[model samples]
Target: MSDESSNEAPRTVRLDRELVRALAHPMRNRILGLLRVYGPQTATTLAGRLGVNTGATSYHLRQLAEAGLVIEDDSRGNARDRWWKAAHQGTEFDKAELLDQEPELALGFLHGVGQSYAENIFSFIDAVQTMPADWRDASVLSDYFFHLRADQLDAMMQEVLAVLEKYKTADLTAPLPEGAEQVTVQLQAFPRETR
Candidate 1:
C-alpha cells in the first residue's frame, strides 16, 4: 500500500533487524495490516474484526507502536478508546540481507506474510461461488512460470510494481464509487530449485 500518484509521496519504512523481529509475530503483523488497510481503529474495534480478545489486541498494538510500526492517532477516539494507525503506508527491505543477518527472524517474518497471503486467497476462493457475476468474472487466481535470469526477473518485477502503483486506489479512507470493491493483489517471485 502506498500513496496516490497525485498526493504526496508514499510513506515507507525500511525494515531492520529490530523492526523485523517486532513484526515477526503473526498477530502484530495482522494488526498493523488492519490499521493500514482500514485506517485508524481502537483495540476493541480491531479485536472484534480479528476475533481476538481486546486485551490481546491492545497488547499487540502496543508492541507495534513500540517498534514504530504503528502510532496513536490522537485525532480520533477518546482516552478510553484510543485509536492506532500504521506509521508507514508500506515497507522496504532486502530479503537476502535480512535472511543472512537473522535467519530465524527473516524466516518467521516471511512465513507470517506468506500465511496472510494464503488466507486472503482462500477467503476469496470460499466466496467466489457466491460472488456476483461481474466480480466472479473479474477475479483471477492464476500463475505463470517464467524462465529468466535474476536481473531479468528483477526488471520484470519492477515493471509490474510500477503498473500496480499507477492503478492503485488513491485514498483508502475515501468512499468508493458504486460497485467498487477493495481488491487484493499479491505478487511473489522466487527461483525454485528444480527437482
Candidate 2:
C-alpha cells in the first residue's frame, strides 16, 4: 500500500511487549517522529539531521524496520541509499491489553510519551518567541480548558476519536497563504477528575 494511503484507519494488530520496548528508546522515538513529519528519508540524511553517527542511525532504523514500524521504499532503488518510511501513518496500542500483564510498564510508557510532548511544546514556544513580529502575529498559540459531565466513558472516547479521525484525514496539500508555514497542533484530552 502507498504511504499516503496508509494514513487511513490502522488495522488492529497485536502489539507485543518487545515492540514497545524497541520504541522506548529516545532516538528511535525521534526517528519515528521525523519519518511521520517528513515523509521518507535515508539513514544518512536522518543521521546528519539528528547529529548522530550514520552507523547508529542505521542500527536503529533496522530495529524499527524489523518491528514493522518502518518499511523500505522499494519503489526507489534498493541500493544502500534507499529511503525508509513509516509503515503506518499512526499506531494504536490497547492499554487494557497491556495493563493486565504489565501495568507498571504500560503506565511508565504512557507517562514518558506525555513528558516528551510537554518538552516538545516548550521548545516550540521558544522558537515562536524568537520569530519575527510578523510571524508571531500570524501564528496561533493558545490553551483551552473545558469541563464536561459524561454519562459514559466509552461514548466520550468515541466522540473524541471521531473528531481526531476528521483531522487525521484532512487534505494537507492545499496551498497556504503568502508567507504562511506549517504549524504544529497538539490535542490532548484526559479525565480531569475521577469520581
Candidate 3:
C-alpha cells in the first residue's frame, strides 16, 4: 500500500543509474524494504531477521544510503549502533527507458524486485496455516485474466492504486483499530505472451 499521509501525495523517487545499481543487489533491496516496512533498525537487528551477518547487512545499508534510498536514523541509536530508515516512501521508474539505457543493471534490479515479491507471497503461504482465523479469512491470493489493450491495462492498474491510496490515507488520518496489523498488499498486472 501507499505510504504518504492523506493530506499529501506519496513521495516517490525516480530511479537514476546510481540508485538502480545500488538496488540491483537483492540484499540491498531487502534491506531497504525492511527499513521501510518496519521503521528504523540497526544492522544487527536487520541481519538477525535477514539471516545474514551484521557486517554484510551494514555494508548493504551503507550502499543504500549512498544512493539516498536510505539514511541513518540518528534519532534512534548511538554512533556505534546506527539505525537506518528508508529515505523515500516509494520509488518510481520508467522501465523501458532503463532497459534501453542500462540493460544489465535494469534487468538485475527487476530480478531482485521480482524475487522479493515471490518471497513475500511464499512467506504468507507458509504462515497462513498458523495465522489467526480473522486474518486467514481476510487474506486473498487470487488472480484474474482479461483481454485488454495496453492502455486499458494501465488504466486498470491506476484504479487499483487509487483504491490502495484510499486505505493508506485512512491509515495516516487515524490510529489503526485494535487488532489491526500491517499487511502486505501486492499488485502485479502484466500481459501473458505464452499463455
Candidate 4:
C-alpha cells in the first residue's frame, strides 16, 4: 500500500501536543495503522476487518479526520460511501521537548503509540516462523544496547528512515513487481530504562 496521499506533500508530518492528545485513543492508533498499511478504504471495509460494526468505525474515522490523522478520499468509492486514509505515513516529535512542555499530554500520547508498537511487535513475533525463508531472513527484529549521545541516536534514526524511504513504493497507483507486498517497517530508538 502506498503511504503518500495522491495530491498532497510527502506523507510525513511532525506532531504537536494537541495532535498527540487527539490520538491518545487505542482504537485511533489501530485504525490509522490499518489505513497506512493497506491504503485508502471505506469505513465498512475497516469495520469488517476490525470485527466492529460500520457505525463504530465511522465514528472513529470522523474523530481521526478531525485530528488531521486521516483524510477523506473523494476519488474513491461512490457518493454513498466515503473512503478514508492516513493523512501522513509517519509522525515524529521530540520526547524531551514534549515532556518539558506538556508532560502529561506527552505521556498519554506515548502510551497510545507504545501500545500500537507492542501489538505490532508481538504480531511480528507470532508470524515470523510462518513467513517464507527469504522474508524471514530479511526481517529486522532486534534491539541492541549501545552507548551514544542523543544527537548520535537521532542521526542513526535518520539514516535508518532514509534507507527505508529509498526503497519505499510511495504511490499506490504505481504497478509494482510480481512479488511486491506491503510491509511494515517499525522502528524504535529509545533508551532502555534501568532500575
Candidate 5:
C-alpha cells in the first residue's frame, strides 16, 4: 500500500453548497479524519477501527467521494475489496462566506466541526499524561480574551497564517529537523457578546 504523503496531490477545496451538505454528518467527518491521517483504508478496516459495521463505512465513503472529499485507491486493494483516501491534504473555506450566504447550513457545518474539534482536544488531553515531561510542558491549553477591532483581529490572524505557511512545504510525516515535532495549532477567535 502506498502511504506516502508526497505521492498524493496537493488539493485544497472550498466547500460549496452540495459539498457542505455532504459533510454535515458526524460519522463522515470521523471517517475522513482517519483517511486523512492514516492514508488508504478498506471499508472492513475502517469499520473495525471506528466500531461501525462495514456497510455503514462503505456508504459514507461513497457519499464523501460524491462530494470529492475522498477517492478510491484502486492500487491499494483488489477487485473484491476497495480502499479509499482523502483527495486533499486539507480543506479551506471562508467561515464568513458561509455565515452570509447560508446561515442554516453554516450553523450545521460549524456545529459538526466544533464537535469534532472537541473530541480531538479531549483525546489529546487523555494522551498528555503519558507523554514526556518536556512535551507536556511545551503543550498548552489556553484561552485569551482579546478586546480588539475586527481589522486588528484579521491582521493578527494573517500574521499567524504567514508563520504557519513557512512550514507548509515540508512533509510532516517524514523525519523532522533536529528539534521539531508535529504540532497542531488550532485557532479559534470570536467576538464577545454585548451584555
Candidate 6:
C-alpha cells in the first residue's frame, strides 16, 4: 500500500473502503488534516490541541497508520514519542470505486467530505470578513466557465488532470506580491450531458 515508487512518480492513491471508513470519523480526519498542514507531531500533542485524551488520539492514530493513510516519523528523538504524517500529498476516489460495492456508504462519505469543505470555505470567508476593508479590496475574485466540444471524455479528463498536476507541483509556499492577499484556487468539473 505504500505508493513510494522509485522509478515512477508518486501516484494519486484511491482510498479503499476500509481506509475510507477509518477516515470517516471526525477526529481521524482532523488528525490527518493537522499532520498534512503542519507536518509530523506526536499523538499526545494532537490530543492536547484537539482537547481529547491522549489514549483516544493514540488509538485513532494507530488505525490511520494501519490503513496506510499515515506513516510514522522515525526522526523523532524518542521511540516512545511516535510522530506521524500523511502518507500522500493528495488522494482521489471516483464514484465507480464506491458505488460498485456500497452506494449508500460512498454517498455518505462524499456528503461528509462536501460538508467539511463547505464549512472550511465559510470559515475562510468569515476570517476574511473580519480583516480591514483595504485588505479585502486588494483581494481578487475570479470565475471561469466554458464549454468545448471534445471527441472523447478521457481527453478532457486528462487535460484537467494535467492542469491540476501543475498546481500540485508548483511552489505554493512562496511569498505573494505586495498588497496581495491569499488566493484560493478552486476547480470543479462535471459532465454537462449524460449519454
Q: What TM-score do all the candidates reach, one by one?
A: 0.91, 0.70, 0.89, 0.82, 0.86, 0.67
* lDDT (tens digit, per residue) of candidate 4 on 14-112: 878777777777777789888877789899999998889999899999999998889998788897999998888877788888899889888987888
Cα-based lDDT at residue 166, candidate 2: 72
lDDT of 4 at 193: 83
Q: Pick the candidate with the highest lDDT.
A: 1
lDDT of 2 by residue, 1-195 (tens): 853496643433346677676677767877877777676889998999789999989999999998888888877656558798876565568878877777877776677667668877787788886898887787666755556655565577688778867755332334556776656666675567657
Residue 131 of model 4 has an lDDT of 92
Residue 177, model 6: lDDT of: 64
- Give the CA lDDT, 0 to 100, for residue 135 in model 6: 65
* Cα lDDT tens digits for candidate 1, 75-128: 988768899988887888899999999999999999999998998899999999
Candidate 1, residue 131: lDDT: 97
Judged by lDDT against the true structure, how good is candidate 3? 0.86
lDDT tens per residue, model 6, 1-195: 343445322445577787778777778877876776566889898999778999999999999888888888767749568888777655677778777877777777777677666666676677777878886676544445556555555677788879866755332334556775445555545556657
RMSD vs true structure, all candidates? 3.3, 4.6, 3.9, 3.6, 4.0, 5.3
167: Cα error in model 5, Å:
2.7
Using TM-score, rank the candidates from best to worst. Answer: 1, 3, 5, 4, 2, 6
Error of 6 at 67 (Å): 0.7
Question: What is the Cα root-mean-square deviation between model 6 and the actual structure?
Answer: 5.3
**Model 2 lDDT on a 0 to 1 scale:** 0.73
Q: lDDT for model 6, please.
A: 0.71
The local distance difference test score of each candidate is 0.89, 0.73, 0.86, 0.83, 0.83, 0.71
Better of 1 and 4 by TM-score: 1
- Residues 1-195 of candidate 3: C-alpha lDDT, one tens digit per residue: 444545433467899877999999999989888877777889999999999999999899888888888888768887679988888767889999999999999999999999999999999999999999999999999999999999999999999999988777333223557887888899889989865
Clashes per candidate (backbone, < 3 Å): 0, 0, 0, 0, 0, 0
Q: Candidate 3 clashing pairs?
A: none
Which TM-score value belongs to model 3? 0.89
The reply for model 3, stretches above 4 Å from the true place, is 1-10, 169-176
TM-score of 6: 0.67
